[model samples]
Structures are given as structure tokens and as C-alpha cells.
Target: MTWLITGGAGYIGAHVVRAMTGAGERTVVYDDLSTGDAGRVPREVPLVVGSVLDGGRLARAIAAHQVTGVVHLAAKKQVGESVGRPLHYYHENVEGLRVLLEAVTAAPVTAFVFSSSAAVYGMPDVDVVTEETPCRPLSPYGETKLAGEWLVRAAGRAAGLATASLRYFNVAGAATPALADTGVSNLVPMVFHRLTEGTAPRVFGDDYPTADGTCVRDYIHVVDLAEAHVTVARALRSTPGLDLTLNVGRGEGVSVREMIDRINAVTGYDHPPTIAPRRPGDPARVVASADRIATELGWRAAHDVQDMITSAWEGWVRLHPAAARA
Candidate 1:
């Protein structure tokens, strides 16, 4: 019942490893440390340093660990960066998954859980997006994730492997400050970085049709999202040949301006946000239904927006002591 968690040293991936291991599951972390901190991986767990693009390494690790399942979390995941470098994203994300799948199918592994994203439903016009929603990814990063889902499902079907793709919404917060996300790629961290620099957090736009006239999204705590991975991993093992694709979110929409206000309140910063032009591919609203995951796995998000802001702010301050509360 050993599981291989690719990208297990990164923020989200590290949390997944911790949750899995803490629950008594035998887990091994496979990460290249491209953006991951090796120290994040617990000493008790084995951390394999290698890229997902390397099939030979993947095969060797699979065999050496007698890995029976895989939770593929390794991928380049920045929308703006992906737009600027599509080829790089394709090679590292899509091509890398292809190579990993080839090795996994060839090995004795029977279960797989892919870390997908809400980005797959690019600019989804729906109020609450479900797994059945049409996928029209806007950015190269989102496209790669959508393609990864297709590859995982098809590969599992042909290989007779159980698979689940958890399409995560906006992920934030941490179980602890050390496990918090370091990248400013997402909204929460982006805001945190600006505030820490004593600069006004810029709201992309405020003319959207939402109540607050700002882009609204479903923000999930990284802890809850990580727990969903464990649930999906175990579910895949129990349900043979399962092809599960569920949204991992709280099913509640939070506006960008509202989030900024929350950040100001939580971090003890009263700075106001400045309005700016909307970024291309920005959806007005993209909240997850979250019904399927709850029904299928009996899981739900226990943290709220305040929890996300405060916990994430704690981590930000830990990394940047200059951002201490006033």
C-alpha cells in the first residue's frame, strides 16, 4: 500500500506527504527540488531527488520502493508564466506526465491520483462549476492540466489502473507556517507579498458582474486540499479501475476585494488596494460545486476565508520577518 508522491517537497505536495504519512500510509516523496525545499519533507519519509521527465528514474524509484500507487503532483503551474513559455510548460507538464505514465503502467502500480486544477475550466461562465463542465483551458498551464487529466484517464483505462483527478480551486493557508506556500503565483500569496513590501495590493479589476464587481473564486485551505488527496488515494485503492474526477473546494465564492479586506484585517495592515486592468483569461466567477467529492468520498472543507488569510499571513511573516504586524 505504499504511495509515491511526485513533487512531494513543494508546498502543496509536502502537505500531501505529511497528511498521508501522518495517517499511517507508507509514502515516498519524489521531487527534483526545482522549487521544493527538501527540508519540508519529513526525515521519516524517503525523499527521492529527480525530475518527472526522467522515465528511467521513475521506473527505478517505482521498483525500488515497490510503489503500488502514485499521486502525481509534479508540474509547472503558473498561468502568466505558462502563457509566456508554452513550450516549456508542455515539455515539463504534458510530456513529463506522458513519460511518468509510461513508466507507471509498465510497473506494478494499480492506483493513481492526479493533482488537476480549476484552471482546466478556463473562464468558466458557470456560477458553480462541476466535474461535468466543459473544459476549455485558457492558459497553457491550464491546458497542460486538462491534457494531463486526459492522459491519466486513458492510461489508467488501458493499464487497468484506478485513477482520480482532483481539480483544485484556489488553494491557500497551511496547517503550519513552515508548510505554507512560498510561491506568489496564486492570489493569496501575491497579496501577501505586496503587503509585506509595504505596497498596496493591486486588485486586477473591479468591473466584473459579481456582487463586489471583482473576480470571485473558491479558495480552499491547503490542508483540506491535501486531505482530499489522501481520501482520493484510498478510494482509488478500494474501488478497482475507478476514474474519479472531482472538484476539491469549499463551493463558496469569495471576491478578490473581499479577500484583500480580509488580508488587511488579518495581517494588521490597513492599506487599501488599488484597482488595475483585468488580466486576460481572468474569469468573473469560478466556484466549485464540491458535491461529488462529498458524496463520493465524504469529505468537506473545514476552513473558512479568515482561516486561509490568517494562517497564510503567519507563514508569510515567518519567511519575511520584515512584514511583522504593526
Candidate 2:
């Protein structure tokens, strides 16, 4: 089936495109290039330059490509930015999804895989967060994602569209240096950027109840996360009207202190991290229980924390050659 992948030129989107194409699935990339690099898309895939907010453009691309399935990944996804610009976040993330869903439901698209986030379960207190966990999103970004899922489900039920929402945790690493994440918004790249500038990485807090006293999170390899998308996308293609909401994570928690230590080791740097005050709304632990995804699709993450840091560092060095010397 020919699938239309929105935001397919971004880091995670690019990985999903490669994984789907590598598995012999036909895909067409739909990106506005606001934050995506057109070069990330493969030469073979047709790149449609458009935003999800544009229904006419979306419908045209869907029809032009004879799209049967869609993977919606285009959205504004910064917690701090979302807090500062709630309207922009709601418009881009929530309203964009509403428009896309309207277009998809109107078309012959049967399968949809939405890019959800663990942030939907903001400040989860449990050791391992399950899908049944109460959703109390802290930031507007998380609220948008949660609302997006609700819209997808409602639209899918109304239109008989098969759908899956994969709530991703901390995604890191890269399949290739060129395909690696270039943005410093994430933890891995943030540390890399600090090290390249000969400064210590800052840990948010060290007074938590955890062993390391720092916030704990579940970090999943981008490759594995992309594979989960492929698995879910194919599942929706095969199983009609199947609705799934599963978490894509390693079922393992890594503390901020430990991650910084690992990053230091992987990058061959001895710089110690500076302890800072805890950021507002930061959870002590937000690990996922991958049991649902594994039981539903037999998918599991293969890469470890070391794999994530090492590959992420390689990509950082490629972008900043001086980082290698540092």
C-alpha cells in the first residue's frame, strides 16, 4: 500500500521513512520544511511540500499518490515553547491534526498511525506507566498530543479507519550520521553541544527520591522507535478497524545523572555535570511498560542506553567536527 508520511523529512520521520522503504513499502513524504530538511527524504520517495493544516493540499497529495495509509508526525513539540506559545502549539499540533483527520476521513485512507508522546501522561508517578495511566498533561504540547489521539480515535471510528497511536518516550540515537537529529532540543544533543563548548552538562535536579536523585526517564533508540512505527503501520494495513494505543519504550528507566555519566564515557570526556534545580513539572520517573506493545505486536526495543549515546555522539561529531577534538 502507498502510505503518505507527514513530516517525513524530520529526524524521527526520516528514520520512519527509511525503515518503511527499506522494508519494501511504498511511501510519499509530505513536509512543509519549516524544521525539516528536504535532504533527509530519500531520492526515490516523492516529496510533497505542504502543511497538514492545508486540507486541499493534503487531499490532493493523498489522491495523487493513491495513498491508502498515513503516518502523521508533523507537529510543534517543545514543552517550554508550548508553554510560552500555547496558541501556536494548539494550532500546529491539535488543529493541524483536526484538519488532517478531516482530510483522511474524507478520502479512502484506511490506516493511520499517529505519533503520540509519553508526555501525554505527564508527571506519571508510577514506576512503569501503562496505557491505562491517567493522562494529566502538564504542558500544552502534551495536551495537544492527547487531544490528537482522541481526534484520531473519534475520526477512525466514524470513518472505519484503522488506527494506532504509539506513545514514544525519550527517543535518541540514529541509523546514520546524515539522518541523525541535528536539533539540540533533546537531552543527548544538548549534552553534546555543551561538551563541544568545553562546558559541563547541566542536570535538572539531584534531590529526587531515586537512587541517583535525578529525574529518571525511559530512553528508546530512534531506530527501534521507527521500527515500531513500521510494525504498527503494517498492522493497521492488515487488520481493518483495529484501534491500538501502545507505548513505545524500553521498559527501563535511566536517571539523568547516569545518562550524563554514560554520555561522558561514550564521548571520551571526563567533564562532570553541574547540578541545577529541578525544572517545574518534572517527574521523578516516567518509564514505560512495553508489555502492551509486545503482547499486541511482538515488538521490543533492542538497543541499550550505550547504543543510543554512542550513535548520537557520532552524529553530533559529524555535524560539529570540532566536537571530536573536544
Candidate 3:
């Protein structure tokens, strides 16, 4: 089963490509390099550089690689930025995906995996979010993912294809320092950057109802998340007409204050964080149930919060040697 991975050179996407290939799966990478790094693609894997919006390029990549499966991971993901440029996000995430679906359905590909997000369940009220959780996305980025899932599932049913939508929570750490997530969009990297600059990391807010009165989130290790993709891919290959939607998370909610404390202990920066007003779209608590993925693929996260901080700090220090001195 030859698999084509879009955005394969990105932080999470890179991990997926490595894990897929390591499992003896035939894989090809398709990335536009807008937010991806070409250097991250392995020499053994063929890299096709083109946007998913380009239907012709996607069709060529699928046909040239003889791809039988696809894992779509390319999209605009920042919440704030999506708010500012809703049209751009829709064009990239929604329209780009529509173009991809057209190509895959026209080809012989039968298995598809979408890189979804917890943002699809914006401000989930439940203690542990499940696959059946109602989706009320807050940002344009999240809305695109939710819409993409519907589109993928519908297309799969019509074309007799197997598909899975994996909604990931907060992802951190790296398999190696060079492959670490360099973007400062997520929490861990943001904290690393703040401490590296000898400034106190800013906790968005501390007035929430939870313990420590800070926003709580579920964190998942990048390595484990990648492995889940491999399992899902294999499952799709074996199960005909399989349409699965699962959450990828540790099922534990770590408060903002708790994460900051751990980051300080791991990095030795130990700077006190200053509290600011809550961001507009920030959720109070959104932990995953994780039971569906476990039952479906027998997969559970092996790494914890400490593991995330240690590996991420190593990568941060690599990019900014001055971080180690702090």
C-alpha cells in the first residue's frame, strides 16, 4: 500500500512520514514548503513540492507515486491568524481539501486519513471529550477541519473508500532535536521563546474556574501521535468502508500553571510567569477521552508532560544556544 503524505515535511507531518516508512510502508511526501521544511523529508522518500490547491499537481503526485492511500496534513492552523484572515484560511484549508478530494476520488486510492484538531470541539463542556462530542469550532481554522471531516467522510462513503479523521490535542516534543517543531505557535515553544529571552512567560489568564484558575489542555507526544497514524493507516487498509473519527490525546488535562511549572523545572529558567487577560478563543478545559483510539488501534500515549518538556527544551537550545545558559 503506497501512501502519499501531504505536508510531510512539517513538524507533525515529518514524524508521520518517518513512522510510516519505519514500519516498512511505501511512502511519498507532498508538501508546498509554505510552512514546511524540505530538509525534513528523508532522502529515501520522494518529495513533491506543490500546493494541494493545485489539482493537477496533486493528481500527478498521486499517479507518479502510484499512491493507494493519502494522509492530508497540510492546512493553516493558527487560531489568531485564522481570525484575522478567515478567507485565506478557508481558501487554504477548505478549498485546498476540496481539490484534494476531487483528485483522490478520481484515482484508485481507497484509504484516507485527515489531520484534524481538538479545536473542532471548541470549549468542550465535558470532562473527557469523546468521538461523539458535538463540534462548535470557534476559529476559522477549526471550522475548516470540521468541514473537512464531513467532506472526507461523505466522499469516502460515495467512493467506497476507508477514511479516518484523527483530532489531535496539544502536540509537543520531537524524535530528534533537528526535527523539533520550530514554530512558536504552540504553548511549549511559546514558553521556550519567552524564557530564552530572559522574560517571564505570559500565562494568558488565571481567572478560569479550574484549579489554579488557568486554562487546561490535553497534551500529546509527537512520537506517539505519529505511531497512531501508522496504526490507523493499517486499519484502513484492512477494513473496507471504515469511517473512523478518533481523538489523539493523553486524556489528562494539564493546567496552564502546571505546564509552566514543569517547563521551569525542565529548562532551569525558573522565571515567574505574568498573568494576562484570557484570549478570545481560549478554551477553559478540553481533555480527550482517548478510549476510541485505544479500542480501535490498541494505541495509548507512552510519553508524558515531562517527556514533552525535556525533548522540546533540547530542541530549543539547539536553535538558540543562549537558552541553555538561562
Query: In model 3, where is the ten-residue run with the lowest total lDDT?
Result: 317-326
Q: What would you estimate as the lDDT of candidate 1?
A: 0.92
Where does candidate 2 have its weakest 10-residue lDDT segment? 276-285
Candidate 3 residue 94 C-alpha distance from true site, Å: 0.7
Tell me the lDDT of model 1 at 171: 92
Error of 3 at 63 (Å): 0.6
* Candidate 3: stretches off by over 4 Å: none
Give the TM-score (vs. native) of candidate 3. Answer: 0.98
Give the CA lDDT, 0 to 100, for residue 143 in model 2.
93
TM-score per candidate, in order?
A: 0.98, 0.98, 0.98
Query: Which lDDT values do the candidates have, in the order given?
Result: 0.92, 0.93, 0.93
C-alpha positional error of residue 169 in candidate 3 after TM-score superposition, expressed in Å: 0.6
lDDT tens readout by residue for model 1, 122-171: 88778899999999988889999999999999999999999999999999
lDDT of 2 by residue, 26-103 (tens): 999999999999999999999999999999999999999999999999999888788889999999999999999988
